[model samples]
Target: MVGSIKSGKSTLTNALFGGDYLKRGAGVVTSIITRIQPGHGLRARLEFKTWDEINADINQALILFSSTPPEDGGGDFDINDEKDRLRLQHDLSRLNTDQLVSDDTLDPNCVLLTEYLSGYDRVKGLVSSEPVTHMFESDDFHKQKDFVGDESLAVYLRDVCLTLEAPRGFGENLEVADCQGSDSTNPLHLVTIQDYLIQTHLIIYVVSSRTGVRRADIRFLNLIKKMGLTKNILFVINCDFSEHETLADLKGLVGRVEKEVGMIFPAPCVFTFSALYNLFKSIDYKGGVEQAIARKDRRRLEQWREENDMVAFSDQQTEKFLKAVIQKVSMDRFALLLVSNLERISSISSGLRDWIRINQDLLKKDAGEVQEAFSKMGKRQEASDQITMVIKDTLDGTTLKLRRNLGNDVERFFDSKSGEIVQDLTRFIRSYNLSIKDYEKDLDASGFLPTLYRIFQTMQQTANLFIAESINPKLVNFVRQEEKKAGDVFEQVAGPYSLMIKDAVKQYQRTMKKLGIKIQDRPFKAVRSPDVDSVKSDARLNIPRLAGTIQYSTRIKTEAILRLSIYKTVKTVKKLLKKPVKEGPDSAMRSLEASVRGIKKQMQESIKDHFLDYKESLKYQYVFKLVDAMSIELYEALTDRMRAFTGNLSDMKGRIENEGLAKDRLAEELASMQTSLNVALKETRALEKLVMIDE
Candidate 1:
């Protein structure tokens, strides 16, 4: 699932499952990806972060309060240190008012800091050296909700895997993931969404009726297109029954959304439904506490049903969406498996029919004629072996050339200094203007340190967005181009060999036909191409974690800020506490410019390290692995087809000679076996026809 916050994704998830297994809220809640799949009974597995991940989260928050980065390039603020903890508390108290939720609460703008400070003692032991896994079964399933719905505990969770008996028609292998909002304030949320998107077979994009289609929706949809995932997406315009006066009003909104979405991708299939209404209707209450809560929601649902006529249409669309999902799960996946098995059946049947014909001809032949027939069969077998060798050598050579060329191309594209992505990021960072005047009011209210922190956050957001918008799309397109190139090259190499294999099969078939054996004459299929779609799941790239270290600078004078207090330092660090107002602002502005330069350097280095890791993954993990797998597939396919025809018949002749059975008795036995094989071939052909029609 993918959408902006408060777009009814969780509600839709519950409606689809026909139960309230997930705890739904109306804000920036669901921080981790939750995967729900069909299983035997109720179960929940919670995966928590490792100690290093926890430390990194704390370091990101504490870096705002720390003076400077250490020599090893880590945060200066240690959680166990008394003075550092005191400084953190002090800094939290004096944080810019605009950055906080309100005077009564801590900063929502910096949720990591706020949650870390409040929940430290509670989660200290929970986060261990290695990652932790906790399982909840049966009656204890509800306990998982506490960790999911609560912001404090949810912060410690990395992911959740829930399994339960789903409604009928839901495949056991099918999984539905409830992902974080696409437009979440946390940059990491977007990164997480992209990661899941790569693995997901279908994306359900939800949009609220109140806001028809926002810029965020278009931007995200555009990104999906660039990732080559626009094909299997289903859009939901989650209707608000209270907002629409009539069915027409809801229909109008749906039309508008579909038109806008069609601009991004053609022929958009949009579904309109009130997820809340469906949720309220789907739940069953036994009695007692559950009944009481159900009563209230039931009343609300009844009112909506009476007031709005669009509920019927919503039901129809919901059914259509479910059917589409079933088709993807059962029909598509099963059809591929079915076709492969049928092809093998066809191959085996053909070989058996040919062997039966050869045996029947031998029964009527004289000893001299039988010897001549054996010689012909021997020549055919030799030719088949030679053909297999040629195909194998050609496939191996082509795969090697593709791997080398693709590796070089990937290396050049992500080269540190002159790479296209590097240059794009460099331009964005150097040209980013950080004017102090934009935050002058907050600067005066909260002093230089707080304002500096805000500036760092602003830059971080901008840079992260830039990468998501520009760099990721470019990488997606580049990988796609390379994938296509590799496919085309392999296709060329496989084309002639495909014909060679077919002619070899045909020659064997003609020899059987000359012996009065009838068989189905049909075109042979080309070699199956390697699945390029694996790039979606295998090659991953996202914005690096730039939140913590963007503000660090060795050039800054931390001692000067420490000697002079918050208010006095704002003036004193500019070289004159008594200087005129204009000159003081000028010196502070100069210092801000220096900080921007330092931030640029940090960002460049971080991106360089990130791409270095990604380059290896793209080459070895995805591209080369894909090539090697394709080579094996090609070799097996060509070898298997010829092997079916050229199987050793000399052993059968040896068995006949050694047993020395009567000729009449042997003929009778062979005729009975031939009759059985013919019946089996007829049945297999019928089944293959059915599979083809279904496909």
Candidate 2:
């Protein structure tokens, strides 16, 4: 499930699962993506961030600490130093209230800084080489809220894998994931959601009725479109029962949301319901502390039902939504998996029938005829080996070209200065205005030093957000394009080989027919193209994180700042910061430009490294691996067709030598095999018809 913060995603997740499996309205920013799958009982496997990842996060947060002085008077803040840690907190306190915290919302960067300072010790022991597992069955399930709902603890988690007893009507293979809000203040939350979307088969985008189609919703929907995932998305306008008085009011709001969303995704499948009401209805509140909360919620539910009378309408929409989900998931599995298996069964049965017929024919023949047939079979084996060599040579040549093309494509897309993604970021950075004049009052109340620090911190956040919102989506799209290209290449190479193998089998059958061994004249089925998902690279595209790369001395002389008039000082600062000069005093503009350039350079290197690893994976792990597997599959298929004709000739001759006991035995064996084969074939045909009808 994906949506903006507090759009009833967690509530919807609970409602869909038939219980409150997740903490609803978690006020803190959620960094971890919770993936739940059908299982026998309640359990969770929490993967904590590695030590290196933790240190990196701390360092990034330190960069965001506006007043953090450079260690030893020149270097960045040392997270491990007690003195620095103390100073870090002191510096945090000095930050302008607007930059530090505004109302309930904290600056994303500061949140990271504070979370590390607060929770590092608490979660350190849990970060080992392997993930920690928890049994959430019986009374232990409530304990999950302690980790998931708490920001400090949740920030330490990399991802969550939760397993609950399969919810009613939930497909056994369906895995649902609850992603962080799309508009989360933390830019990394957006990046994390993109990664999940790439792997998701379907996206249930929840939009709260309280806040109809938001700008964040549109931005996220566009990103989904850019990633080529518009078709599989289902939108839900989660109603706030308190906000809307009547059923008509809710319906009108749903229509507005659908129209707005339809502008992005045509004919969007939209459902309207009160996620909270659904949750309240479904939840089995165990007594004790839960009883009071349940009683309050039940009262609210009663009032809403009595006033609005929209329960039946909501239930109808929800049922339709559930049915749509089941159909999509089931159809995908049936078309991609079941049909392929059925085809294999059909091929195997056809081959088996041919083999039996050949053996039965050989059984009627004398030893002399069988000897002649064996000689012809030896020649066919040599021919099969020749076909194998051709397949190997073709794969080797095509795979090398495919690897080179993929490597070059990755390099071009991530080039340091001129690359598409880097350029887009660079343009945004250069055009971004800090409006130093607006902070003049801040400069007067807070010294130039503190205000200067705030400006730099804002730049860091702005640049980070740009990369997350703009650059990350392009990177995902690039990888998807590359995957398709590689798949197409593999399919092209496999086509000829599939045909060649089939032709070879046909020739062998014709040769056997000349030897008076009757063989079936059925044509070979074309091999199915290698599935891209089957060979998908395990490497996830991790957009390099934004950190405090821009460093400058904040220790200006206090007397010097007080000496300058406010108007003159503000003018000087703006010119110093915003001027496009290649050389200048440590102006905020120059610092920001330098920082952005450095970030772009770092991003380029990071992307290059990622693609280098990804290229190798595509070659060995995906492309070449697919080629090898398909070659083996085609070879085995060819051999299966001809093996019984050749390999069984010796057995037929040996049985003939044993005093003519072959005919009766061969007849009985053939009859039993044909009966079983016929039954299987009949069932396969029936399944094929059902699959066709379903499609």
Best TM-score among the predictions, by candidate number: 1
RMSD of each: 4.9, 6.0
Cα-based lDDT for every prediction: 0.71, 0.67
In model 2, where do residues sit more than 4 Å from their true spots?
A: 64-84, 101-105, 128-137, 284-293, 304-309, 431-440, 537-683, 693-695
TM-score of each model, in listed order: 0.85, 0.82
Q: Write the per-residue lDDT of candidate 1 for residues 377-474, one digit (tens) a residue.
A: 77777888889888878888889899999999989999987889988888888888877678777666765556566666677667877776677768
State the TM-score for model 2.
0.82
lDDT of 1 at 513: 64
Give the per-residue lDDT of model 2 (tens digit) for 1-695.
99998999988987777677787777556567788888876777676776666666666555424454333344545555677667767777667676676335677767777776777677767776455544466557667777788888888777777787675666677788988889887666777777678777789999999999999999889888877787688999898878987889888988899889989899999998888887777663433444234667778977867754688888888889888877777766556556655666677777777777877776677778877877786687688778767766766677667667776776677665667876676566656765655666765676555564455566655666776667666776776676677667766766777677777787787788789988767766666555555433223222233222332222222222333344346667777898543344234333333434444444444444544454455445544454445444444544443443333444554665676575787679788999998998888888878677221
Query: Global lDDT for candidate 2?
Result: 0.67
- Model 2 scores worst on lDDT over the 10 consecutive residues at 551-560
Colliding residue pairs in candidate 2: 577-589
What value does the lDDT take at residue 590 in candidate 2? 34
